[model samples]
Target: MSRPGQSSRLLICCTALIVCQFVSQLSQAGVIRDKLMERRAQQSEMEEEEAATNGPRFKLPPGTRVLEDVAYGSDAKQKMDVYLPASAGDHSAVRLPVIFMVHGGAWAIGSKTHNKVVENKVARWLPKGFIFISINYRMLPQLLAREQAEDVARALAMAQSKAAEWGGDPDQFIIMGHSAGAHLISLLSTSPDMVAQFGVHPWLGSVSLDSAAYDIPAIMATKHYGFYDKAFGTDPAYWRRSSPLHALNTAGAPFLAVCSSKRPDHPCDQADYFVKRANAIGMRASVLPQARSHGDINQQLGLENSYTQAVEDFMASLSPAIRRHLE
Candidate 1:
C-alpha cells in the first residue's frame, strides 16, 4: 500500500499534467483563431478598396443620368461626377438645384469615386429631383488648406459654368461637405469675398456636414489629435487665416452646421460656437447636433431618419420650390 503523502503527491502530479495539456491546446486554438480573424480583416479591406475604386455598385434609378470624370480643371484630381435627376418631357425646362458634394479624408487623401458614403446620398436624392455633384480637391502636404479651398472654388466655378447643360440652376448651388470638405465649404460660405473672388454665381446656402475645425485657432490651442498637425501645421497665423470663425465678419449665405454631439471638442462645441458667432455677425446660421460618429454624420444624412428630415428641412428653407418638387 502507498503512503498517504506519496498518494497525494501522485494525484497532484496528474492534475498538473492535465492542466498543462489543456493550456497547450487552448494556446494553439487561440493562435488559429487570431490568424483566421486577421485574414478576414485583410480580405474585407481589399473588397472595400476595390469597391471604392470602381464607384457605386448599385444601379441608379431610371431616367437618372450620371456624367463621370468631368474635368473641372487641368489636374487629374480636379474631376467630379454629376448626377442629373430625370424630368418629364423637356429636361432643359426643369431647372434643378445643385448639391455640390465634397468628400472628406483629413484634407489629404479622398476622391469622388472612393468615398462610398456619398453613394447612398446620390441614390436617395437623385430620385427626389436634386442634381448632385460630388467633387475632388487637391490634398494636403502638397497643398495646404487654403489652396484646397481655392481648388474647391475653381471646381465650383467650372460646375456653375456647366450647370445649365445638365438642367441645373447655376444660381441655386448649395454646397455640402463632410469633415475637411465641410471646413472648406464653411470657409466659402462665411467669407463671401472668397465666393465673390471665385466669380461663380452666389450659392443659395451651405450644409456643413460635421466639420470639427470651424475655429482653427481654438483647435490649435486645445489638445488635438496628431492629424490636425498635418492639416493645420505649426503656424498660428495660418490657423486663423484658414479658420471659418476668424472669417465670419462678412454676412453671407445661410448655413446649417451639422455636427456630432459625441465628440467633446468638436461638432458639438465647435459647431455651436460657430453658429453663435455667425448669428452675432448677422449671418443666418443654425446648429444641428446629432448623436453619431463624425463619418456617420455625413453618411446618414439622406437616409430615412430624423437626421435626413432635418437636412431636407434646411434645404427647403433655402428653396421652397425644390422641396415642393421633391414632394
Candidate 2:
C-alpha cells in the first residue's frame, strides 16, 4: 500500500546522493591541485633566488667554462650543470673522462649546486682536465625511490649523448653520489635491467659515498627509522628490486664504496657486505673506511685529505693512465 508518488520520490533521492558524491570528489581534487601548485611555485622561487646569488658562490679558475641548466628532460628538475676544463694543446683530439655527480637529500630535497659542493668539486677537477657534471632529479613525496633511479638513468643516457660536445669522453664516464644519491647511483650500477631500460652508456666505474640503502631488505629486516618506510614501503618484492646488493648477480663495473667508519650498521656494514658479494660474483670492488661523520665524508671530499687520496687511488685504477703510472 504505497502512495502514488512514492516510486518517483525514491528515484529523486538516489540521484541527489550520486550528485553529492561527485561534487565531493571534485572538491577534494581541487584541493590537491592547489597544494601541488603551491609546492611547485615555492620550489621555482627558491631556485630563482639561488640563481641570483650564483656568481659570488661559484668562483671559477682560469681556463674553466661552466654551462648551467642544460635540460635533459621535459621536467624542470631534469637539468644538469657542466664544468669544462680550459683548452690545452691538442686537447680537442682527446676527449676527457666525465665525473657525473648526484646530490643527496634523503631522496626528498637536493639540487645540483647544493652546499657549493659542486663548485668546489669542479674547481678541483677541471684543472686536471676532467669535465664535472652535477644533476638534479624529481624528489619525493612526488616520485618513489625506484622512479628517481630511473630519472638518474635517464640523465646518464642524455649526458652520454652530449658528452663529446662538452669535451667529455662518453665511454669513460664515472658515476658518483653521496647519501641518497649514492643509493640511486648504486642501483644504476648494479641493475642491468635499469641500465638497459634507460639506455645508459658503459660507465667506467662507480663511487658510492656513505650510502646505507645498498641492502634494502637488510635495512627492513631491522627496526626501521625515519625516511626508510617513506622511500621503500612494506613490500618485500619492491625492496629486493630497489636493493643494489640484490641487483648484483654477474660481473659488473668496479665500485669504490667509501664509508664513514663512525656510522654503525650502514655505509660501513653495507659496504663490507656489498664488496664481499661483488667479489664473490667476480666483480672488482673494495671498501674504504674513513674516520669521519657521514656529512664530512661527503663535504670534505676533494680537499686532498687522506680520505680523498683513497678515493683518488680508486679513481686512478679506472684511468687509462693506470698502467703508465705503474710503469
Candidate 3:
C-alpha cells in the first residue's frame, strides 16, 4: 500500500539493521579469538623462558653413581634422580645424609635433570658423602600449587622408604628448592600436618631459594605476574591454603629462606616475613638476602664462594655429622 520510494527506504533500513548486528557479532568473535591467541602466545613465551634456563644436560661427576628415573608415582613426570656418593658401595655400611632438591619453573615447566638444578649441587655435595635427590612433579594445568606440594610429599615418602637401598639415612633428610619449588617446600615446612598425612616424616630443615610466593594472598592482592593467576586461581580461600605464611601453625622444621636482593619484587621482604612468623612459633628460621640475580641464587649455590660457604654453614647447623662433612 506504500509508495515505491517509501518501500525502498524501509528495505534499506532493514538491511542496515541486519548489517549492524552481523558486524557486532563478528566484532565479538574477533575479540574472543584475539584473547585466546594472546593467551597461547603468553604460554609459548613462558615455555621459551623456562627452556632458556635449562642449560646443558648434567654430566655425572667421577665417583658418584646416579639412579635415574626412579618412579615415585604412577605418572611419568613423578620421578627422581638419586645421586649417591662413592662411599655407598655394594658392601659399604655408610649411610649418607640426603639432600632432596626440587627444581623451579613457575610451577609449570621444569625437569629434575636441569643442569642448574643438579650440576653444581652434585659436584659440591656428592664428594661430601651426601645423597642428592632431584625430583620432577606434575606441573600446572594438571595439578595446582597445593597438589604440587602433595606431590613433593609423596616423592619424599617414597625416597624415605627406599633410603636403605641407596645407603641413605632416612632420618637425615634436608629439603631444598628454588623459586616455585621454594614456595612448595616452604608450604610443606609450614603445613606439617598436611605432609604427615602422606606418611612423610619430619625433615631436618628446608632451604627455600628466592621464593616470593610465600604469601600467596599478599602477592595476589597486589600487582603480580600473570603466571601467579594460573598457579593460584581466583579463590581467596585457596590463596590462604596455598600460602606458606598462612599455613604456619606449629614448628615442624628449621628453615633457611635465601632471597635475591636484586629482584624488584622484594623476595627478601617475603622471606623476612615468613622467617619472623616461624621464629614467633619457636621454629629456627632465618632469611639470607644475597645481592645477586634470581638465577644466580640457584646456579651459584654450590660454587666455591662466600655464598656457597654461607649455605654450607646453614646445612652444618642441622647436624654434627653434616658439620663434620663441611669442616
Using lDDT as the measure, the top candidate is 3
Ranking by TM-score: 3, 1, 2
Measured against the true structure, the TM-scores of the candidates, in listed sequence, are 0.81, 0.80, 0.84
Candidate 2, 1-327: lDDT as tens digits: 767699789889999999999999999998887666545433422221233224226577797777888888999889888877785234568777788999887777767876544766776667777788888888788788888999999999999999888767788788998888899999888988889987986888999988878899988888545467778878999999999999999777899998887754446988899899999999999998888876677778877677777787788888674322212
Better of 1 and 3 by TM-score: 3
Q: At residue 187, what lDDT does model 2 achieve?
A: 88
What's the true lDDT of residue 36 in model 2? 69
Which parts of model 3 have CA positions greater than 4 angstroms off?
1-56
Clashes of 2: 0
lDDT of 3 by residue, 1-327 (tens): 999999999999999999999999999998887677556534432331334323236676687777888999999889888998888755766578999999888888877877778889999998888899999898899999889999999999999989988888898899999988999999999887878899998879899998888899989998666788999999999999999999998987889999998875778988998899899989999999999877788889899999999888899999987887778
Clashes of each: 0, 0, 0
**Pairwise lDDT winner, candidates 1 and 3:** 3
Residue lDDT tens for model 1, 1-327: 999999999999999999999999999998887666545423321221222454555667778777888887888778888887776224457677889998877777777865454667877888877888988777877788877998899899999998888888888888998878889998887766777787767888899988878989887897555557777788999998899999888778899999888754446688888899889889889998999866677667777899988888888888776677557
Provide the overall lDDT of each model, using Cα atoms, as 2-decimal numbers. Answer: 0.79, 0.79, 0.86
Where is model 1 poorest over a 10-residue stretch in terms of lDDT? 42-51
